[model samples]
Target: MENKKERYQVALVSEDQKINEDINFFLEDRFHIDVFSNGVVLYNHLTKEPDKYDFILSVSGLTGVHGLPLKETIHKLGFSHIPFFLVVDKADNDMIQICIQNGITDIFIKPLDKITLQTRLDFQLKHPVVGWKKRKQEDKGFNSYKMPFVKRVFDLLVAGTVLLILSPLFLIVALLIKLESKGPVVYYSYRVGTGYNIFKFYKFRSMFTGADAKLHQLKHLNQYSTEKQEPSDLEPERQEVKELCEFCEQAGGGCLRPLYDDNQIVCEKIFNARKKSDKESAFIKIKDDPRVTKVGKFIRNTSIDELPQLWNVIKGDMSLVGNRPLPLYEAEKITTDKYSLRFLGPAGITGLWQVEKRGRGEMSEEERLSLDNDYVKNFSVWFDLKILLRTIPALFQSENV
Candidate 1:
């Protein structure tokens, strides 16, 4: 028998009694478990006895104390070093990404299986980032998505089937992108993935070549507002960009009668438009970001532009379903433990974030972060496929995919 000192001390912050009981059943065999129904009681207990557990698992949508906000307060009070494994039952891609970046050590979905639960706990005990991943493989009961190897087969099958069916459309898109844009058809980018690993993400180029070079000049959008702001350059830019959008009505060719006077009329209108557009609107979004080109807008709306990421899934850089990958700057917004939990899975192509609260022309860093946490806590393969299936409907609604 292993020494009790070597055993992991885990604090499960879950409101659901069945889940708590189930977790205890699987964990009792290998861990010294202390479970609580909510964050307040657990937090108070921690205050009373400062260092009892080796790791902490914080569940999103808990009773009384909400998920991400609770994490922010906990980190603020300087209990940050204690590992926090986040739990989510309902969340989107962006929310999960923020969680991993914040500091969440790990994440688990509800109705966790016996083996998976043990695997995660044991892994964490020896390799605890936040909670423990149990090393010893012991199964005393029914598995949720039982058969680890079978799960892998399903993932491959789904990935393969999607790839085969979408091949023609993928080709057509590639050609159209090449024909429409001067740059490469598929824009490959170095993005961070699970374990902070860097992987190349593919997307239909929505911006012109040297687009990144222009980001510095276009950062002017960030100059808007920030009472609801954090310490991020990206925050300011979002507002600034949204502020700059009044001209979009004109840019998108919306709400204006076309005049055939001359090119000078176009230029004059464009100039006047930019100046007048610099105002706060009811719907915090820039309708016509001067940055997006005609092709860019179309690509964004049709959702065709995002299709290239399927290749990322094929290559195993990402999963068919999981949290969205963070573009370096976006990842920095998360500054708490609950944030890191989002990064636990292989980054995904279409995620809970996009299907639920997509860029919709106006989503905040905080809102995205919260949703990411929720997704992480509630991740599952079945859930992933279901989200992917529902995603097709959203493509029609998307301005740019």
Candidate 2:
């Protein structure tokens, strides 16, 4: 008697009913497909029965919860060992780069080519990702027998001494904060740190009470917001581009091919025209923000706002030198696994980026993240000391804090 081959279990997440049907029809014969509509449902199911599925296939921009964020959640849940494949409508250079960073096994762009997908699936199955070797290697030094101990001891000694000496200054700052603001003197911010750990990050309140409520009013002041033209302003140009796209599609060319190909003169012209209209920057900075109070300006400029974080360091919520802990909103933006490596090291009030750039308005978001990754990859006791020394000078620099 011959033994029957065991079928591979695959989980498919897509909000589109038609896409789900198509994927199921194509894959059901060879694999057991568990279909889900949104990332939340899929995530809950996976958490309960992670071992049931061999891999996951998800749509990139699902409505309820997006794929990249879903992947981040999975990693946080300690289920990163499972492989993921994302399906996208049009894979641009940025999207492809993001996918690569997120540890996606493969990307299947729409008008899904069934044959190519099958081949890719077969290849992935044959070569399953046993572990994230690169991330492991980057983290190895920090995780070694002696480094963590040495790092913690240094944090204790330094943070302890600073708190003791700064106690009087802390009292003065607390009183000033109370006189200026109606809210608590110390702002306890919710921040995401190493390994997706959540902690209350301490800082002096550098903005007026209810400042967060005024964010919408200040959107125009956000330096990172991409400049936009009113729809009416761009309608004619958009129609022209639409016609060009249709022409290319009719001429046996892909709708997205022109956008991806720099050699396409027509495409390049239209793209450049559109590019000139949209001014985008990744880093957000507002010149002389009105949200800050008079005392707030002084504290932020002199880096006094960061003093209360010494308590967090002593409490073991952070280290003296590591990646800066991110607010939940900011952390959510960094969903890619490659960018997530920034979380492998400890969260700190000051790190390589702070020492190197001192909140220079010129630093791009990617550059900042890269510095965090660099610190993780090359962290040592001596390196930390050097960064600490450099931080002293940076504290006096008159730049955006």
Candidate 3:
């Protein structure tokens, strides 16, 4: 006696009922298809029963909790074993790059080609993703593209030429820095770069001597610090406030009773928490910081402080165009595989984000990280050249130091 073959389980997420029906009709013979209208429902179902589906096919532009973000969520939740594909009406190069970065298995364009779709689906099903080999190949290719012999020659030539031409300016800046502040003319910090490689990054000193010692005193002025609120009696009815007060009392912690009427119990608490951990903000910046010397302000605003980094490029610690390297503190926070993708390319003096958002102060931290990831995914030699050209104009823009 022969046994019946079991159908492969697939979860389909799309808002359009007709499209869902068509996909079901095509795949039902080989797959036990489950349909979902939005990402939220699909996510909930997957969370409850992660092993229920062997594959996920979602529309790119679903209304509540869109496909790309949901894919990221799934990846973050360690659901990389199941293959995920996106069906899109249209997708640009940037969108495609983002999809690839998020580990999307494949993208199917709408006005669906039934035959091609079936062929692709069948191929992917037969060849399940085995290990990290594919992802490593992609990273290896990106890293190779970023550090070709030609690029190395370009970096050496450009950095050498720039350093030679700017020697007089460097001397003048060093003199100014020495005359104004009692410290070394150049600043060096340990920075993490490609492959999480640690190297000493150079820059002209842009703050006062012993400025680091005063960081604790000026932490309140840190632009990136998570804001904390002093609890008050007005919010006493809130359960969180009550619980905090109870915790404080039991822990023998200080209370904000002095500021409240009738000596009501109140406990200070952090509010509007930062999305990133404190360690991730190792490179803190403050606008109009008091720690900067007179010469420091001028050099930083005009980007003269960045000149010494040409030496770093010459030493092969950085490139002319790539993602900015992070400080060790910040690098430690990106230990996860997905976030670590930013390290697949060489570190740079000026990169995609710096050129794209020049003089734009409203960019969020997540947006900056996304730009770095995008650069790692899409960068080529020509792309690097374009970024370098764009950076020349951006130098005069009013960007942060």
Tell me, by TM-score, which candidate is best. Answer: 2
RMSD of each: 19.9, 8.8, 18.3
> Which 10 consecutive positions of candidate 2 have the poorest summed lDDT?
231-240
By summed lDDT, the worst window of 10 consecutive residues in model 1 runs over: 135-144
The lDDT for every candidate, in the order shown, is 0.58, 0.70, 0.70
Give the TM-scores of the predictions, in the order they appear: 0.47, 0.61, 0.53
Q: Give the TM-score of candidate 1.
A: 0.47
Models sorted by TM-score, best on top: 2, 3, 1
Kindly provide the TM-score of model 2 when superposed on the true structure, using C-alpha atoms: 0.61
Best by the lDDT measure: 2
lDDT of 2 by residue, 1-401 (tens): 97786688888877678878888777776788888754545545664575788778887542113466667666655556667888765556755775677777777887777787778877777776666544434332212112388889989999999999999999999899899878889888677777556678899998998987765455566555565322232212212224355455667643443333211223533554665244243345665789999889999899999999999999998989899987655665565556767877878878999887765665656678899999988988899999998988888887754
> By summed lDDT, which 10 consecutive residues of candidate 3 come out lowest?
257-266
User: What's the alpha carbon RMSD for model 3?
Assistant: 18.3
lDDT of 1 by residue, 108-132 (tens): 6665778976777677556655321
lDDT winner, 1 or 3: 3
